[model samples]
Target: MRATPDNGLKIRAQLEREGINVPSLSERTPSANSKSDRKKVIMGAVIFVLENAADALKFVPIPNPDAIPNLLLKWLKVYDTVGGNDDGLKELGNDIRKAYATVLQPLELSEQIPPEVVRLIGGFHSDLEEQINEIELLKSQHLAKRTILAADITKRISGVRTCINNALNSVSTQATILTLLREIEASSQLTLERLPRAAAEHTYVKSKSACRPSTRVKIQKSLLNHLKEAKNRFVWLRGSPEIGKTAISRSIASTLEKEGTLAASFFWDKSRTGVGLDSLEWFPSTLARQLAIFNGDFKASLVKRLRRPDSELILNLLPEEQMKTLVIEPMNRLRGIFSASTQRFGIILDGLDECGDPDALKSLMNLVLLLDGLPSAFVILTWIRLHQTRLLTQSG
Candidate 1:
C-alpha cells in the first residue's frame, strides 16, 4: 500500500492517481472569504501533481482532457472523506491541462494515442448528444398531444350545451317556461330574460282598476293558477260580438308577448277583405314574417321573397310542401324561438263566430293542435249564446 501523506500531500497524490490536475487540499480551501488565495493554492497543487505523475508514470496525458476531470468528480463523490468543493474540482481540472502543456518537453508525453481510445471517448460524446435530441423531440410531441386533446374535449362540451338549449327552445308556451326553469335550475339569468312581460302587463291591467285589493289579488291569483295548469286545455269563451272576448284574447296575447312568450293569434271576421282568414295564403306568409322578425338570418331570406316582383305569384306558386315549409315550419319553429326569445307564447284566436264559417273555426283548431302539439293556446270566440247551437252543429 502507498504511504498516506499529510492532508496537503495526500490530496496531491490522490489528484495525481485519480488524474485530477489541481493543487493540494490547503490551497484548494479558501480562508473565509479568501477566494483568490484559495484558487491559487489549488491551481498550483494541480500543476505539480500532473507533472510529477507524468514523469514518474512515463505516460502523456490524453488529448481529450475531459476524461480526467470526469474521473476526479467520480472519485470525490465515491470517497466519503471528500467534502463539498465544486470550484476546487473545476480549478483542479483546468490546472492539470495547463501543467501538461507547460512541461511538454520535460515530460516526453507528446505521442498521439491509439484509435481504440479515441473511439471510446467519441462514442460517449455521441450517445450524450443523441439523448439530448431525443429528449427535445419527446417534449414537443407531448405538448402537441396535450393541446389537441384539450381542444377536442372543449368542442364536445360545447356541442352538448347547444343541443340542450335547442331542445328547451322548441317547447311551446308554458312548457317553454318550465323547460327553461329546469335547464337553468337556480340561475335567473335565462328565465327572467325570457319571461313574457306582455303576460305580466295584461295581468296588471286586469288587476289595477279593481276597487278591492283583496278581490284584485284573488283574480290575479286565479289567472296565474289557470295559466300554469292550462297548457293542455281547450278554451272557448262564447259571448256576444262586442263582449269582452276579443279584449281578453288581446290581453292574453299582450301578456304572452311581454313574457317573451311564443304565441300566434288569428282573428276571423265577416268582411272578405284580404285581411281575414278568407285569404288563407297570407296566413303562412304573415306567420313566416313573424318568425323572421324573431330570427335574424331568416329575415333577409324571407325579405328577398317578399320583395320579388312576382311575390304574389311566388306566394301562389308555393306548393303545399313549400307553404308548410314557410308558414307551418315557422309556427312550429316559434315553439323554440319564441320560447328562447320569451318565456311563453301560444295561439290566440278571436271572432271565430263572426267568420260565419264554422268549418273555418274547426279547421283552425285542428291546425293549431297539429302544428303546436299542445293546447296551451287561448282562443276567444264572440258569438251570441243563443246562436251556439248553429256554430256547434258543424261537422268541421
Candidate 2:
C-alpha cells in the first residue's frame, strides 16, 4: 500500500533513463545506478509521509516517540529492496533521535505532569532501552539467517552452477600459447596464483551465493559439528557429476573462510588439461604458499625448507617430503600457536575425480590425511570416483 503503480512507473522510467534495465520485477535487487537515486527518492517519500503523520497525530494520544522513527524505516523498506540509502537513512535516524531528545529535553516535567506520570514515562524509557539492546542482537542473528536462506532460494530457483569452466573466456594466452602451456607442464616451482589460472580458469566462487545454502544446510552443519568429534578428521562427500558436490564444497570453503579457518583450496578439473592435472603434482607446495601468506612462522620455515641448493635446481623433491616439510611442520607449529577450540584449520580438495593421474592423487590423499593426529584440523574431499573408494578407505 505504501508504493503505487505510478511509483513503479517512475522507478522503471528512471532505470531506463540510466540504461539500467532489470529484466524482471522478480529481480528487485537494484543495479548500481538505480541503487542510490531511486532509493533516495523512495526514502524521501517515506520521510514525508512520516512527517505528515506526526503533524496530524501530534495532539492525539500516542504510544511512544520511539515508534515514529521505527515506522519511518519500516515504511521506507517496504519499497527499497536493497539498502541504497543506508548512509542517508542512518543520518535521518540520528536526526529523529536528536529531535525526540529535544522535545523530551528533561524540562520542568514536575510543573506539567503528576509525579506518577513522570515515573511511568521513566519506566517506559528504561523498558524501551532494554528492548533496543535485545532487538540489536536479534537483528544480527536474523540477518545472517535470512541471508543464507535467500541465497539458497535464489540458487535453487535459477539452478546456478556452483562452479563453471571459464577456460574459453580466460585471459588470452595470445603469444606463444603453446609455449606457455608447455612451460606450465614442465614448471615445478610455480606460485599459487598460476594454479587457479592454469586450472581451467574457472569461476572463483567468490561469495556465499556460489553455494546453494539450503540444500547443504544440514550437511554443512553436520560437518562442522562432526569436526569436533574424533570420527570427522577426514570428511569425504561422494556424488555423481552435476550432483552439486562442487557446490557443497564451495559452500563449506565459504563457511570456513568466514570463520577464519580455511587454510587453502585446490579445485581440480580435466578441462584445462596440463594446468589442471599439473596442480596434482605441486598441490602441497601450493597449499604451503597459501598458508605461509597467513601464518608468519610457516612462511619462515617454508622459505628455509625451499631455500636449499636443490630448490633452484630442477625441483625434483618427492611429494611426501614436500608435504611433511613444507606443510606438516609449519602446520604443526601453527597448531601449537592456535590450540584453542575456536581456532581451526581446514583444507578443501574438490573435483578429485577429475585428476588424471591416480598415483598423484594417492600421494595427495596420503598428504592430506596426515593431519589426522593433529587437533582442530580437517580435510574435506569432494567428488565421485567409485573405484577410488577402496583406495580412500585403505588410506584412512
Candidate 3:
C-alpha cells in the first residue's frame, strides 16, 4: 500500500516516542509516476520503520543505522514503478513484498550485520527482478506457461527467505570480528602514545637556518634528484666547517615538507651544548615520533613493535639498535603498501661531527650505514665536517 500522510504522522509520532524527530510526509507530495518523489516517500517510510519499530525489527541488525534506508530503497525500487497495469508483474511484486516482510518477521534479534550479508540480500533481489523480467518477455512472445512461471515465483520467494535467514545466522560471527578489530585499534593507540619523543630536534625550530633563496640552488637540485632517483639510501655530504651544510639541509627539509615527503630531520649543534643536542640518545625516538606522524601505516606497524613485551628496552638499546627497532622495522613493513610511483621520504641528519661523544658519533654512522639496506624510496642525507671524513672511510 502507498504511504499516506496520516500513516506518516502516526509513524512520526511513534518515532518521537523513541526520541527521534522525522519530518512529516505532508511536507512533500507523493507521485508514483515521479521517480524522485516516490523514492523520497519510500526512504521516509523505511527510515521511520527503522527508527520507530526498533524492537519489532530487532532481527535486522544494522551496525550503521544511516545506511539501511538507502540499501532498502534500492531493493524496493524493483517494484517501485509498476507501469501499464500488467496483472502478472503486479501480482509478482505483491508476492515479493509479502515474502520480504515474512522473512524479516521470524529472524532473531542481532546487533551487527556484515557487508557480505547485505550483498547477498541485494543479489537475491536482483535475481528475483531478472526472473520477473524474463517471464514478461516470454509472455510478450506468446511463449509463457502460467504453471511454470508460478513455480519460478514460488522458488524465488523461497530464495529471498533463505538469504535473509543466512544473513541473520552470520551476524554473531561478524560482530565478534568487528569487536576484536576495535580492541586492537584501541590498544595500538595507547602503545603509540607511550612511545618517547623529543620535540625540540625538529627542523622547524626557530634557531634553524635555511639557505638563501638565490643561493645553494645547484646543491638543493642535486640533493632532490638524488632523493628521487638514487638507488642508494644514504647520501653523505662532507664539507669543511662554515660551508652552510646545515643551511642547505634546512632548505631541503623545507622543500620536502612542502611536497609532503619529509619523514624527519635532526641537526646536532655544539653551540646548544647543555640541552642534550650534542648526544644521539634521543635521536631514534625523535625520528620514530616524526615518522609515526608522517604516515598512518608506518604508525600502525611501529605501534605493533612497541606493543611487544620486550619493547620497553628499545630506548635503552644502543643508538644503532634503536634505529633498527624504531625506524627500519616499521619502514620494512610498509614495502607492500608503497609503489614505484610513491614519492621518496627524505631524512636529514646535519652536523653529526659536532656531537661531543665520539662513541655516539660512531654509533650514528653505523646507524646511517645500516639504513642503506632499507627501501629504495627512503632517502637518508647526512652532513658532517671534513674532519669526520675518515669515520665514513673507516666504516666502509
The model with the greatest TM-score is: 3
Candidate 1, residues 1-396: lDDT per residue as tens digits?
111224345455545677765544544343524755554454445445544543553454555434333332233222112122435344334433332333222224536644443444344434434433433343346556545434443333233223222322322233446557556543422322221112111222332231333334453344444554545334444566544554555555565566655344555444544443443334444445454444454454444444456444544453343345554543453344434441333445555554446555554444434444322342222223446545454522
Candidate number that wins on lDDT, 1 or 3: 3
Candidate 1 wrongly placed segments (more than 4 Å) = 1-225, 228-230, 240-242, 271-274, 277-281, 295-314, 317-323, 331-342, 373-396
Rank candidates, TM-score, best first.
Answer: 3, 2, 1
Regions of model 2 farther than 4 Å from truth: 1-209, 228-231, 276-279, 308-314, 373-384
Residue-wise C-alpha lDDT for candidate 2, range 102-194, written one tens digit per residue: 223222122343333334444434443444443334334656655643344333212111110011111112223545755753443343333
RMSD of 3: 10.3
Residue 145's C-alpha lDDT in candidate 2?
A: 55
CA error at residue 166 for candidate 3, angstroms:
20
RMSD of 1: 28.7
Which lDDT value does model 2 have at 118? 38
Q: For model 1, what is the error of residue 27's alpha carbon versus the real structure, in angstroms, after optimal superposition?
A: 81
| Residue-level lDDT for 376 in candidate 3 | 74
Candidate 3 structure quality by residue, lDDT tens digits, 263-377: 8888777777565566777777777878887888888889889878999878778788888998888889878676564678888888787666776787778777877756777
Each prediction's Cα lDDT score?
0.41, 0.50, 0.63
- Minimal lDDT window, size 10, model 1: 192-201
Task: Give the TM-scores of the predictions, in the order they appear.
Answer: 0.33, 0.45, 0.54
Put the candidates in lDDT order, highest first: 3, 2, 1
Q: All predictions: root-mean-square deviation over Cα?
A: 28.7, 22.8, 10.3
